[model samples]
Target: MRNTLIGNGVIIQHGGADYYNANIIRRAINNVRSGCFPSHLYPKECADFVTALAKEHNAALNGDYDRYVFTTYDKASLKDFKSRYDRKHKHSPEEIGFEDYFLLFELIHNKLGVKNPERFEHSVVLRRMFLDSVFNQGKIETINERFSDGFVKWLENNDYIFTTNYDSNLDVVTRLPVHHLHGSFNTLSEIYDPNSFRNQLKDDLLDGEEVDLNYPHLYSTCLVSYVGDLKSFSMTQSSLANIGMKKFVKGYQDSPDIRNQIDEWDESNVLVKRLKEAIRLKSERPELQHSEQYPHKELNDISGALEIIGLSPNNDGHLFTQILENENITEIVFNYFSHQEEADAKRLFGSKNISTRDVREFWLDVDNK
Candidate 1:
């Protein structure tokens, strides 16, 4: 009763169910505030947090004591610290996630004083994160020095990669094309000068005098933009208003020439055109374009399969579906983490070529292939 791949014409649509897999701001926040680590207030609350998180998503421990070693404290300093700490600290996704979250929090709470403490107390871990003022303040620059090639190496060991097309060469030949979805954390400062504003103001105000205001705002804004709620323009509006941004917004909004120029600004520089071109070329000649010599293109083809992996399937990229349908894809293999996701994928693509299975088995089959 199942369709099968019998020839080159038969497109074998295989999709691995993956989360966005990025250490986004929200995941980072929950990792820090999840109370996974013991505190004076919640002394025996380790398993509770870990268990809850595990039920929600899959976690792998390459080493047992990894978490303990990484996040260790002086046990001898305390009298009642009897539980054995693993000390191996394998850098859980949550752990890395927390660090990213805390950096954003520091940008906002420490620099911008713009955190919703009330929301923090009420299942904050479960809520969707928004790009806040701290993000708009450019705090991402603070972590630039810390994010070197070494971090990329560590991320490879941990199965995390940058999704962006630029920033580093990142052995595109062998490894899973670690797409740093966002721009590189390090290049951010160079891309947007941290002290550009202060330097300009000083130049305008003092003519030639040496004026230096520690550009913490620059760092804060970078971080804020990285983690800010892009859907709402309120944060940027308030941010601009605070720094006398009325003229800039008005000029951009009012001047016809400015508006015309703005339309040409490719502000995000998302590389959509390049991707579309690649897809068009690949679709035209799948044999040549999908060759092993072009791993990035192959990955793109994999990502563009009828069944999506980490995507939420809001149909934002309906073209992928159209391509699959037009090619007459009769079957799709999807690895679902839970029954709910399997049911959901089935409901959404039931009329098409989608079949859900356990992630573990899917990987096993992949290995054999």
Candidate 2:
């Protein structure tokens, strides 16, 4: 029988939950509290928005709400806010909405040039230091090397690979095609410029214009939204920008400069267009639609069994459901980290036509054999 391997963020030892919480989320909180960006570089409106956002996030981190607070708001608060937002706007709270404020800050920073380029350069260096502390290393690299070596050999011998991670560790370790469902950090620099929007937004008259949206990364746009179990919103870039403007900008939508910038970004944004097309296709063909691009379609087209590693079905219920219902998938192996995860996998995929094993145990068995 044929087989396909799927992976998620947990596969990246040092770059998983721990790294994100420490380097990205914690760093953001600390930066906001300490005023990492100079006041001179911030316009009054942008400064006020960041200050308010940071304050709210600080309150949430202090444990003001009972539920896992991934961001500045407690889960309960987020749910309520989402409910109100959906009812008022006639749309659901998307996963991308959570990161809108952060993206807005990045956009504003680019719009207003840095007051001191030297200081900004120093800050970038310092920021990289923090990221490196979590990402660069001995043990993590060793594990990644081993996993990639084994996994790539298996894929080349048979089947395909799909992952829902943002890192390029898999790409670096193997020459084989490993599809990244989520945007990757490696492509971030190519798609976005923190200092200016010239490369991404500006149209070159000499060059034949083509918006390459496929394999689009995070840095491509200020508006980013992800659809999940909750009611999905229109994934178009313009729609998302409107949602963001309403949520973050308050009365600034009337500003010509802000409107023009958003419009330019929307026109050039390949990711947004891609997502919109996916949404359209999903609507037209729900049963066959697996995910935005490759994950869903490829999984459905698989002629054999599937092996899942480190992916939680909570955020990807639709994809999981599709896999279970696909007649082409004759068997499934779930490699989980914990008993609870195993239980959850069983609950989702069921006992029949499915097998469960700890990730470590599975790897050890593979190595020993």
Candidate 3:
């Protein structure tokens, strides 16, 4: 029956029903706060405080974290938002975000504060992590089943699939291509592979600064560490309203734009170099441009009935703009779980005459009941 699910061509966007994912500001607190610094970082209390703080910023929004970022990004733009994040810690940006609230509440401020002489030139040591989970690979099967075999076959058959996910777990049954809009690992390995966090841990996080908490047991293994570590790869400062941030490893001078000052092995720098390498290899050979499958083109051309699973609109404004304004998209589907999410989707789609449906969840027995 799902073969009939789409009467037209469909474009898929991966949302939070993901292998390892977090959406709201409270749920994501543990990632940025990390066991790395907070010795006493536990769920019940931290969650209570974050949930309360999120409520204070916008009572109507409750604890919907995206509400903060979406408004901030809509005003400042991601690039400007990121470029000005260091300023958000001390002076407020034109638009405030969740990160600003953290500073406003004095939860994340350090000893140096805004007075550091080099603060003007230094950027936060942003991190991108893909946590390896024993449960990650198995979710692909559940996802495929929830999506339905008929639906999966259609995506595979037409080469119409694109994911923000950095993993190729869909290849278990897929033959064609699954475009990775965000970055992916340069190697061929399951995301659930043990080495993901283990390789990252060896990179060094110790700086001279004092940490909020210290738990040595968390450092002993990849499994425990993964639980207390960062999982998101793309929450940048631009969406953060210039909020203050913590660095992964300490010693640094000069901006990322300054190549001479950057360490060759720095993790954040490495992500930058990968993109540069990708561009450099593709740039010299103009002939390959024609043959290369540009993900942007796929996005620009996204038509038919659009099914948005769990894709967050925070960091991916460019892609959302294309689809949001695309006249060719006849219908839209939001696989949302709560009344809050359904209302959020309606607001997101505002004034679009095209029919949009909100289904509760893919895994639920009754999708829309």
Candidate 4:
């Protein structure tokens, strides 16, 4: 199958996708207090953490803070951002939304430059801003241009699409299969539903059955949306590095203390163990079983050439690493929008297996053809 990776950049040009863009999310974040946060996101234990941070950030800024929030895109350099922000902030079990802020911003913010508010706990009264901004975004849509047309054609040829975007912009416009690497609003919201068919399959998914998705891992991973300029990978080092999945790293600690194995986690003990077995069943287990029954895992086993567009090198490190290591994938066609991005693609993908293209040229050809 031919495979293509669609990134956030291509959809940013579309109007419907503007809802989840940083500006909208940021504005909502900077505005609400909720008496107790979004009706859905706030834990009864903690009133509101994320909303309060925005209020405080607002109080601290004598002038507009927007000018400064976006200035430092790199997390390493963000240390010098403010003496107050220098220290690493931690989240408690009640402070779940704040940690989520760190994770989601990396995936969705793309370039809108959202800030990981310093001292998330201080904003306990902060409204749950993500759901507020995301849930109300009417309908997300994308059109048949800018490779959407070409992507549609490729679907007929059995090409696979893997996108890091959380919105169903492509799904709305094309109704094609889009594997959202970090998860999306639709999937996440459905899992929350008590009666949804996907939610009903939760147990089967956990039991390593050909059943769809349960919670502890994949569901937890995608439904989670945190708001950050901290960069997605940098924010969740504890989850990915410690061998615990980032989505399950929600617990009370001055800093997140994730375990190296699933057996150690006591929260959803059984489901967690089953999640490990499920992943193990699909990941390098002796049987080489599970196979295509696991469609998400199959995203990695791309055998034909890969055509990539709009994917950020920083968003999903582990997946990118696998793509680099996969021998089945013939060549990576990395598309860039500018000279600087061309340089970034060169550094990230290297020359050994990748050939670069200017996005404008490629799509113009597609639209022309």
What C-alpha lDDT values do all the predictions have? 0.32, 0.45, 0.36, 0.47
Q: What is the Cα-based lDDT of residue 349 in candidate 2?
A: 79
The alpha-carbon deviation from the true structure for residue 164 of candidate 3, after best TM-score superposition, in angstroms, is 1.7
Expressed as tens digits, the lDDT of each residue in 22-44 for candidate 1 is 33333334434664321321223
Candidate 2 residues 47-158, lDDT tens each? 2443444444323334343333334322433453344232223321122133333322232333344345544443333333233323332223344554535555655555
Query: Residue 260 CA error for candidate 1 (Å)?
Result: 15
Question: Candidates sorted by TM-score, descending order?
Answer: 4, 2, 3, 1
Q: Write the per-residue lDDT of candidate 4 for residues 1-369, one digit (tens) a residue.
A: 678777766665444454435545554444353343333343433323344343343222233333334334433223322322312344222233333344223322333443444234322223234443444433333333444565456544546777766566666655777777656655533323444332332365323422223221222224232323322443343234335422333322113343344435554675555555444333333332211111345555678688887765544455676687777887788878787777877788784477888887876766554
Can you list the residue pairs that collide in candidate 2?
Answer: 96-225, 96-226, 290-296
The local lDDT score (0 to 100) that residue 266 gets in candidate 1 is 52
* Candidate 3 TM-score, C-alpha based: 0.40
Compared with the true structure, what per-residue lDDT tens digits does model 3 show for residues 63-181?
A: 22323333332224323334434432433121344333433232112222543333311212111111222123223333433444654554554425665544344544566665555
Residue 18, model 2, lDDT: 43
Best by lDDT: 4
Count clashing pairs, candidate 2: 3
What are the models' TM-scores?
Answer: 0.29, 0.49, 0.40, 0.52
Ranking under lDDT, best-scoring first? Answer: 4, 2, 3, 1
